[model samples]
Structures are given as structure tokens and as C-alpha cells.
Target: MGLNYQLVLWNNHKKTYDKLIVLGMLLYIILFAVVTLVFNSETSIETLVIRAFGSLAIIMLHIILVIGPLARLNSAFLPILYNRRHLGVSMFIAAFIHGGFSMFQFHALGDVNPIYSIFISNMDYGSLTDFPFQVLGFLALLILFVMASTSHDFFLGNLSAKTWKRLHMMVYAAYALIIAHVFLGAFQQETSPFTIGILVFGFILVSSLHLITAFKEGHIDTAKTEEKEGWLKVCDISEIEEDRAKIFTVEKERIAIFKYDGKLSAIHNVCKHQGGPLGEGKIIDGCITCPWHGYQYLPANGQSPPPFTEKVATYELKLDGKTVYINPKAFEEGTEVNPCKI
Candidate 1:
């Protein structure tokens, strides 16, 4: 929403969200340290800080990963999704602290550079139990640092949304590296069954949530479409929720048919901002809003309001009894078309 670069477009909501996150993170660290002290009185402060921050980072990463799929599964999770960037940046900070402290405690006094030592000191790649797991964590931290550094809208605009999204998608690779780091490092040393069970349960829960969301969307994409001449049947009028859209795949192209104000309109399902799934968003202020970044387009025409040049292809829609149908052929981007009356 800026012509040039912007560090951040902060608002009251973002301030409140950030404050709550910081408070929660501090509380979690304090509680974890207290519990560790009670259980093992001889545990050193450095070890406690390492474990506390490492656990917090992993927990934050899990929350960040789940927010997307959870929001897609239910609209109530949208607020969490909206402020996910903050959570990601916070996670990187926690991880940085853990990494810094570990390096100081274990490798700083050595002859070689600590950063270099992280890689050269751990050469047991052939053995799973003896592998240099610190290297995995270092690489993952590097990726997270990159992502957090370029998380602003300025980066998104300058790098182009497509490139930015692809770069950010490296988080999945980072997550895998972190999982291996934990399993090969901490889990190998921790003998508590409770800790092992929790790790396994978290992995299964995150994996299942992602799989369920993917399958649900896949079913929608594979839905049968009835075509007559140039128009393709979308769905019954009653099936579409008010102010919301029902997405359809017509001839390999995805279209979003929205029912609002007792009328129907169709637009390309992809948002120009980040290729976000526009169909999943709801109508706000009489404009079709994108779920990913809140970009908007008028329903009657696929163009954004003045000062914003974004646009999408508009499709011709028709109503027959209670059924809604859309022309398979899309008009040129920003083309104006009348909304079909319900």
C-alpha cells in the first residue's frame, strides 16, 4: 500500500498483538526456567537459557506453521494469520539468542572461529547419533534470519511478490532442518519419555493439520463442472455464503464466484499481491478482499480503487433458476462487467 519503501505500516492492532506475544514469551521462559531449577537444582544458568530459548523458538515456529492451515480451515483463525510476520520475527530472535549463547559457552574459547567450528568440529555425518547437529541448527538459523530480514512489504514489492513468496517458502526447509537438529541433538541426550512423547505428538499434529487442509482444497479443485456453450455451472445460489465466494476450477483455470448484495460476480481466483487464494477471502467494505494481505478489488469490475493499479480478469456470470453459471472465457484484466442478479 505504498508507492515507495515502507519499514512498516503499524497500527493499534499490531501494537497490541506484539505486546501480547512478548508477554506470553517472557512468561513461558520464566516458567520453564523455574521448572528446570526445581527438577535439577545443579543445572547452570547458561544451560537453562539455552533450553528455554530453544524450546520457545521451536514452539513459535510450530505456531507460525499451523496458523496458515488453521486459518484456511476456519475463519476464526484469521487474526492470528494477519499478524504471523511478527511471530516469525520473534521466533528468529529467540533462536538467535540460543545460538549466540551456545556458541559462547561451547566454542568461543577454541582456537578456531566459533562459526567455523560449528561446521568443522562436527564431522560425524556418517553416524546418526553422533552427527554434528549444531551445523543443522546454524543453517536453519541462517534461513530464518533471511526470512525475518525481508519480511517487510518493501521487500515484497522490490523483489516482486512471486520471488518473495518463493524465498519465504524456504521456511519449510528450515523447519525440517530444525526437526533433525532437535532429534539428533537434544532428543539423543534427553532420557525423559515425556519429552520424547511431546516431540512426536507435535510432529504428528502439525503434519495431520496440513494434510487435512490440503485434501479439503484438493477436493474443491477436482469438483465436476457442467458446461453449456461458453458458460460453466458453478453452484446453486444457496450454496454460496453471503459476502463470501465459492471457488471453482473451470477448464484448468480457477475462478471465484461471489454472492453479495443479492447479486453474483466472478473474478480470477488469484490475487495480484502474492498469488493468494482470493476465493477464500470475504467481501469487506463492498470490495473483494484478499485473505493474505488485505488487497481489494471491486466486484463489478476486477480493478482496484484509484491509486492502486492492481486488477484481475472478470468473468461473465448468468443465473438460471437457483443455479449460478459463469463464462469459461475471462475478459481482459480490469474489464468491467455487470453483476448478474440473483
Candidate 2:
């Protein structure tokens, strides 16, 4: 939930950076396209590759855009949220390549103006047989360009989160447009009844899975952030052993109470990545290691040490007589509760 867009020294060109990821991805696309175009004994393989890659690219973009909203409903899906923008920008590049190829190869032949030809060539809005399919891709690409241009955190910071969220809602519209593009453009051309049916079935399957997850997660109020509760007695200070933690659920929130080296600290039981239970994780040196992915958080504050940035919210704790009680009231995320009266 914390999006600190502050300028920090990050090695963006590292092999892990999204640009390299997409660049390598596009390179593979180019390699495959070249191999298919060159070796296709039949002449139509090049065009088929273009349309197929184009559809694949747009569908991926839909997945990238929907992940954040999807994660709100499913804890298992948060890793996609943690790493989504890379996928967005990658899809943008794919769409751009697909659009450019379609324009140059199909529309720019002879003396046709590509832009004008793209619009006037297709007007099949009335009937399935006469549908204007190319327009759908053009419109979807436009949507993608707009969204990709503003995908950076700078825009998220400048435009308020709410406004940015609303603006980005164009993704759903783009998804529908691309689906229509696939049906009208490729399915209409290939009409190999079986392939077209398979494509539609695949599309429906992926979309149905997302819809089912969204329906399930829709009941969760992701907007509800702060956990407010009166002090709840958990266990005797003696019952909490060294280097171990007890977890409790209060107000639909899971919290971890830790006892390490005679000190008590409390943090959100869920890992920031995918809600891994922190209480079940072991301590490494001074950091509490997440049980699932080994993401480390300081026992003092939920902040990750140098070289990693993920954070979790921490709560106030006290040893009331021998009984430990938690002030379930949440503090500003990333701040530590030094519960020990040193």
C-alpha cells in the first residue's frame, strides 16, 4: 500500500529491470517471427504470426492491468501486484510492434494512406460477416498507448490515486476492444471453425477464471485499511518462548506477537508479498524471515533492511503484569514498536 515515489538510487539497467525483461521478450518475438516468416512453406505464416502475437500481447496487458484489483480479493495474487508495471510496459511494446507491422504490411501496400485505410477498410459494425475488425485493434492500441504513457509512478503521484485509478479504468474497455479485435480480425480470417472455437474457448476460460476470482474477492473491503481494536489479552509473557511469535486475528486483521532475546515486538502476521504468516517464520540474525519466501523484516520495525524495500504494518504491544496485551490500534506502517521497557 505504500508507494513512495521518492527518487532513490536504483540500478534500473540491472538484468532484473523490466525494460530488459521486455526487450528480451520482444527479441524472442522477433526471433520467432523471423523464423516463421522465413521457413513457412506456405506464404501466410508471417501474417498468422503477426495476428497471433498481437492477440497474445493484448491479452497479457489485460492480465497486467487487472492484477491489482484482483489481488484485493485474493491474497495469493499479491505478488503480481508487487510486480505489475513491467508487464504493462512490455505489453505496450508488443502492441506497438503488432500495430506497426499490421499497418505497414497490410494497409501501406500500393499508395494507400495507412491511417485512413485502417478506418475505412473495416465497417462491419452491422453484421458478423461484414464487421470492421482492424478498427478494434487500432482503438485498443490507442488505449494501450495512453495507459502506458502514464503508467509511471510520477503520474500516480501527480494525479491523485483516485483520479489515476479512474483514468486507468480504460484497461477494461481496452480488454473488450482487444477481444473483439481477436474475433473480428483473426477468427474471421482463419474461420477454421475449430481454431476459432478453440481461441474463443481459451479466451472464455481465462476471462471466466478472472471473473470467478473477482466475484469471490469482491466481498472483501480492500478499502478498509486501519485495524482499530481495544487491547486484547493474548498469552502470558512466560508462555511466549524466545525467538518465537504467536498470531491472533482481530477485526479481520492478523497480527504477530514476537518474543526474541527477552524482547517483545509485534507486526502484521501476513507477509507483504503474499500474506505469508510471519509468526511461522524464523529469525535470521536481527531480522524475522518470512516463512514462505524468506522476505526479511526487522523485529523492531516492519521495514526490510538495505537492498530491499518491502514493508509491513506493526502494532503497539505491552506486558501487562505477566499477561501480554496488544493495542490493536495500528501505527503508521513501517514504524517499529520497541515494546521492551529498556
Candidate 3:
């Protein structure tokens, strides 16, 4: 929503979101430390700190991964998606803390460089039980570092939306590495059923949500609609709620047909920023507001309001006895099409 590159301004909602994040992280870490000390009185302080932060990071990563699919499945989850980057950065901090402490505890005492020690400290990669799991964690941390550093709109603009999305998608790789790091490293020594159960539960939850959401999205993408005179028939006007949208996939593009002020307009569903699902958003302040980042565009022209230059392709919509029809051919970005009155 900014015309120039500058530090992102924190709104009241963002401030509250960040406060919750900090509070939750602090609470989790404290509770972890206390629980570990009570359960295993002989555990060292260094080990407690390492495990606390490491476990917190793992939990945060799970929450982060679940947010996207959850949002897609139900719009009620979109509020969390608004400031997900904050959670991501916080997760990286926890991970860095864990990795840093572990490096210092296990490798810093050796004559070789600490990072070098992670590789040379363990050469038994052939054995599943004695593999160099820290190396996997290190690589994952590096990927996370890249993502967290470039999480701002400045980087998104410079790298382009596609490139930025692809880069951030490295999260799945990082997740795999972290999973391996946990199983091959900690699980090798700790064989508690509760720990293993938690890991398995998290993995299953993340995987299942993703699969279900993917299937839903795929079905929508491949759905068939009646086409007449180069126009595709969508649902009736009553299907869409006021200020909401019903998305249709046409010509390999997802188009959002929004209902507001007793009128209908169609625009590219993909948000110009971060490629968010604009169809999932609602009308706010008379503009179509992207649920992901609050990016707003005029339904009449697919253009952002004055002082903003972002735009999306528009489509011509027609009303035939309460049924809506859309031309698959898209107009140029920011092209104004007269709305179809209800």
C-alpha cells in the first residue's frame, strides 16, 4: 500500500499481532524450560535452553506451514495470514537461537572452527543412527535466513513476485531438512513415545491439510461451465454474498467476480502483490481488498486507488436473468468495464 520504499508501518492490528507472537513464544520457551527441569532434574542448563528454543522453532514452523492451507480452506483463517511474515521471522529467530547454542555447546570447544566442526565432528554419515544431522539443520537455517531477510516488500518488488514466491517456497525444503534433523539427530537418542507421537502428528496434520486444499483448488481449476458465444456461465447472482466474490477458472486464469453495491465486476483473481488469491478477499472501503496483505483495487477498473500503481486484468461480465456470464478473454490491466447491474 506504499508508493515508495520504506520501512513498513505497523498498524494497530499488526502491533497486536506482534504482541501475541512475542507473548506466545516467551510463554512456550519458559514452559518448556520449566517442564524439562522438573521432568529431568539432571538435565544441564545448556541442554534445556537448546531444547526449549529448538522445540519452539519446530512448533512455530508447523503453525506457519498450516496457516496457508487453512486460509485457503476457509476464509475465517485469513486474519492470521495477514501478518504471517512476522511469525516466520520469529520462527527463524528461535531456530537461530537453537542452532547457535547447539553449535556453542557441542562444537565451540574444539580447535577447529565451530561450523567446520559440525561437518568434521561427525563423519559417520553411512550409519542412520550416527549421521551428520547438524549439517541438515545448518543448511535449513541458511535457507530460512535467506527467506527471513528478504521478507519485505522491497525484496518482493526487486525480485519480482514469481521469483520471490519461488524463493520463499524453499520453506518446504527447509521443513524436510528440519524433519530429518529431528529424527536422525534427537530421536536417535531420545526414544520417548510422546516425542515421536508429537512429531508424527505434526507431519500428518501439515500433509493432510495441504493435500485437501490442493484437491479443492484443483477441482475448482478444472471445473466445467457452460460456454456460449465465447462467454462462460458462472453461478447465479444469489450465490455471491454482498461484498464477497465467487471465483471462476477460465482460460487458465482464476477470475474473481465480485458483488457490491448491487453491481458485479470481474477481475484477475491473482493479487499483483505476492500472488495472493484476490477471489478470497472482500470489499472494504468500496475497494476489493486482498485478504493476504490488504492490497486494494477498484472493481470497476482493476486498478489500485490514487497514489498506488498496481493493476490487474479486468473481464466483461453480463447478467442474464440472475445468472452471471464472463468473457474468457481478459481486458488489459486497469481497463475499465462497465459493471453489470443486478
Best by the lDDT measure: 3
For candidate 2, give the lDDT of residue 120. 77
Better of 1 and 3 by TM-score: 3
What is the C-alpha lDDT profile of model 2 across 105-164, one tens digit per residue? 888975668998988776657888668888888988898898888877677657754577
lDDT for each residue of candidate 3 in 1-342, tens digit (9 for 90 to 100): 756899778989999999999999999988887887788889998888899999999999999999999999998898898899999999999999999999999999789999999999889989988899999999999999999999999988888778999999999999999999999999999889999899899999999999999998998788889988988899989999999999999978899999999999999998888999888899999999999988999999999999899999999999989899998999999999999999
Query: Which pairs of residues clash in candidate 3, taking residues 3 or more apart in a chain or in different chains?
Result: none
Q: Across residues 275-315, which tens digit of lDDT does each residue of candidate 1 receive?
A: 78889988999999998779999998999887888899999
Query: TM-scores for all candidates?
Result: 0.91, 0.57, 0.92
Span of 10 residues, lowest total lDDT, candidate 2:
219-228
Ranking by lDDT: 3, 1, 2
Q: Model 3: residues >4 Å from true position, as ranges?
A: 109-111
lDDT of each: 0.89, 0.71, 0.93
Clash number by candidate, in order? 0, 3, 0
